[model samples]
Target: MSDPHSTAPVPSPRRRVGRPAGRRAGDTTTRDRILDSARQHFARGSYSSTTIRAIAADADVNPALVIHYFGSKRDLFGATLRLPLHLRDQVSALIRTDPDDMGEHVVRLFLTAWRDQNVRTPLSAMIRSVFSDEGAADALGQFLATHLLGPLVAASRRDRPELRVSLAASHLAGLVIGRHILGVAPLARADIEQLVACVGPVIQHYLTGRLPAVPTE
Candidate 1:
């Protein structure tokens, strides 16, 4: 028999030099990989910041394929949230409105969605996840910033569009967290129509009115 050490030395796995060795050759799993990538990114950091290219890189697929399979980042987020809410259609209505009346539309649509049990359960889960899990928070935050507020900002002449988005989102998030999720006293018991009228004006103010100036030196 040849000597035990007769073979030449084997290379040490090439150290995988860069990018932590993302997935490869996803012929059957390309679509799944995109989702996997999206889930990973959404769950890992600021979900609002995750991009199509970033997800594609993670899944070892082309960015175009992400579009092919999911159409857009917002759609991908909907899939990730996996809620049955007619979220895409609801959100679509926001961009096609008169800017001055945008707040009422946003509030009305939000309350309308919460009216359905099928929609509320998953939405509750999404909000709960945002509260309890960093990754989930990232994902939801990203989804709201990109899907909900981004369009509003584009159509807004509001100073500090980013702040406008944050204000409006925070208002809605608080309403849901308190009224729906936590079942706060009067809010939980109030009529949806009442809440819409009450909150709609507030949201419009946030979206369009000038802020009171902070006292300064």
Candidate 2:
């Protein structure tokens, strides 16, 4: 017979507590993988050529997941632009590099920076804006002088440093604008190594070579 009449305590039913409501585990890692894949695509081709399906395939995730994390292709591009935060440091380190070969280093760096669409878009936009906006021109000039040319010029210890820097800057600016922004044929499709070989020496002469004296008024 059961001791129902006896005063005995019985255990209540145990309820299982599920995980807290939020992102699933490994979601962050998946998002990062998608971002990396997007950067690779942007680096290899222009933004117009890179597609969500391609990025998803590269990331090895479903296309929906990429959209779920980054929203749209533009949004993904905006995210990739943030990846070059260390570029300034790379440029700064040139000051400590060998001045003899600095031109090659500089040309290589320039090509690398403009090779990707994420960084190239803003740079091209700023350059185009300079035609109509004096403020943009001034800002661009100041940036080029301070960040790009100033450091290399100081390191070269060449005569007429200002003129040398200007010449070198002009050559490099023209090259990038024609090859990338304007998409000039032959030059646009030229191998990066071929460009480095042909253009690097000209930059070297402008920055570190002896030049004829110009009579000043």
Candidate 3:
């Protein structure tokens, strides 16, 4: 409503600043980029050695963004792989079984579960990773110790439960490696019931038997 020719200062448009490089407008593809980078890093490297900062640099995003999106390194490792679902439920079921028959059930569960392609593929990958990489071995051992074997051992209520868990887990891991991965002749061709019968008692002994005293160094 003022004079048409009056001199007036015009407002400048607000400038956007401090956006991370390679982060596109609206940040649409950032998550996908991070995941893609994670897959690549995990494929070639051990889980322990692969850092969030490394993955972020590879993805062209900030490390904080990786944490924001995926939570943690372990979470990122899980994201990069295809694993079986309802695993905790299966473990829970195992925990609910008869204590004496638990060894047989545990062996049977491993043998039967491996028959499923969905379960076998990921498990095989994880086991293979363990065999090949010390870092991965540590990570997987910690995960199994913390998540799966910890509860199972607690249920046994046995003396030196930690050692019992270790022995039982080591036996089962060897069974998977020899029978499934390495293709050990008789073990590879052995029937599930046969192996279960042979291995089950040994596992039970490890879990519930009187272990020898630890030797002093």
TM-score of each: 0.59, 0.57, 0.66
Q: List clash counts for every candidate, in order.
A: 1, 0, 0
Evaluated with lDDT, which candidate comes out highest?
3
**Candidate number with the higher TM-score (2 or 3):** 3
lDDT of 1 by residue, 1-217 (tens): 6688778786777664444333344554666667667767765554446788899887766687788778887677666655344776667767777888888888777777776754555456567667655655555566567767767766776677777888888888889899987989999988877888899989998888787776799
Candidate 1 deviation (Cα RMSD): 9.5
Rank ordering of all candidates by lDDT, starting from the highest: 3, 2, 1
Q: What lDDT does the true structure give each of the candidates? A: 0.71, 0.73, 0.75
Candidate 3, residues 1-217: lDDT per residue as tens digits? Answer: 7988977877799776743655644465887788778767765565656689898998877788888877888776655443346665777887888878878877887678778765565456557678667756655566556656667779889899989878887888889899987999999999999999999999888877789998999
Who is ahead in lDDT, 1 or 3? 3
Off by over 4 Å in 3: 1-63, 68-75, 78-85, 116-118, 215-217
User: Per-residue alpha-carbon lDDT of model 2 for 1-217, expressed as tens digits?
Assistant: 9887987878889866642222453578778888888767766665556789898887877787777887887667656544265667788888888888888887887788876665676556555545665644554555556667777888778889888878887788788878976799978999888899889998888878888899899
Error of 1 at 62 (Å): 19
Best by TM-score: 3
